[model samples]
Target: MRLVLVRHGQTDANVRRELDSVPPGAPLNELGLAQADAAGERLATHPVTSVHASRATRAQQTAAPIAAAHGLDVTVHDGVHEVFVGDLEGRSDREAREHFDTVYAAWWTGDLDAHLPGGESAHDLRARYLPVVERITDGVHGDVVLVSHGAAIRLAAAALLGDTAETLYVPNTGLVVLVADPAAPSGWALDHWDSAVPVPGDVTAGGTPR
Candidate 1:
């Protein structure tokens, strides 16, 4: 089985570098749509059998073009949602670093026990994400695409690659490819990973380039 994990495109939260974990979702901005389209074009050559997305609006929107081209519906999976930020949600990176020192430290150190202020821990994230991956691997026999959040994708990749959590970094709309073979002793191997925007020209929102 081959798994292609993609981080959703930029949103206002992304541009502002705010932590977005709240409900009622934020849809993708223009650059986001273009990134999603670029991602779809890149995957057009691959034999993707299914597309899965988080319930988040940005994720759903990012999955749409790919699904349309592939004639597959986006499978919404709540388990793939971004890490809940609690009081830190909507806060800027600077603000988070200033006020949530322990949380930031934990994150920097890749501490599994570090929890966001009133939110879930990295360990909690692994618990939630890994099971879904297991299910996908068990059910899908072909290439699968998953559009999700940055932190979640990083955690998933770290877990799958047996690397330190702090070692994983995925840029906006990044793609990380993993090949899982039950026949292999390791079970899974990293095939390729990149955050290169596949779009040819500079994408714009309204009249301004991002």
Candidate 2:
């Protein structure tokens, strides 16, 4: 099985550096639509068999063009949703850094048990996300595209890719390709991390992927 992990396009909250993690999340901005289109075009040769995305509006929108390219419908997966921020939801980045320092630090440190007071722990995220990833990789024979959020993708990459995760930074609409390897402990092998799109120029200037 081959997997393509894509980060959702930019959102309004992304430009503002605000934390938007709840349902529906934020809608894509103008550039985000273009980015999604470019991403679909980039995957033209992949022969994607299925397209999946988080329930968030941003992720769903990002998945649309890619799914259309393959004549596939975008399947919304709750397991791939963004990490819930709890009290930090809708708050500015500056505020979150100052108030949620411990939780944020723990996440960067790869502590599976770390989380904000009302949010999900790293272990919680894995329990929900990894199973979905494994199920798809195990069941699918052809390539599959999974459009998910920034932090969630980061966590999963860290756990699945190990050393390679250090350089696997997921930019907005950026792509990561992985292939199944039974001999690997993680049951997958990193083919590429944060692969570039064939788009001529950068689609995101002020916004970040989420």
Candidate 3:
């Protein structure tokens, strides 16, 4: 199976560098909508059989255009949501950097056990997210696209690649493609990690990276 993990378009929280995991709301801003549309146009060439997104509005909005083009409804999965920031949710970057020193340090260093103030730990995020990924892989018979948060997608890529979390910090709207062969021990191989704004092209337009 080919799994394409895509980070959602930028949100107000992203622009302001705040942590936001509020559910069913926080819709995309104008720039975010444009980004989503661009992403969707690029994805239109792929043989995507399924589209999945976090229940968060940002993710849903990101996936909507693709789903509409493909005539598929996005399957909302709660497990794919961004890590809960809890008390730190609405804080400005400067505020968080000042008050949540330990958490910020841990995040910068990719410590999975590090917990945000009153929020979920990176370990906690992996525990929930990995299983959902497994389920998605198991159920889908072909290529799949998953629209999710920046942190969640980064951590998920880390888990899948058997790398440190620090090794997988993807930018907003980043795309990571992985090919999984259920018969192999490791089962999955990283195909590419591309961040260039995807342009309209034939499915075979881009070459695989070495």
lDDT of each: 0.72, 0.76, 0.71
Per residue, candidate 2 scores C-alpha lDDT tens digits across 49-80 of 99999989999999999999988999888788
**Which scores greater on lDDT, model 1 or model 2?**
2
lDDT of 3: 0.71
Tens digit of lDDT per residue, candidate 3, span 95-188?
Answer: 6645455653475476778877787777887898988889888857667999987667766777786763234445556688888856545677
Candidates in order, TM-scores: namely 0.84, 0.87, 0.83
Clashes of each: 0, 0, 0
Rank list by TM-score: 2, 1, 3
TM-score attained by model 2: 0.87
Please give the lDDT score for candidate 1. 0.72
Candidate ranking under lDDT, highest first, comes to: 2, 1, 3
lDDT winner, 1 or 3: 1
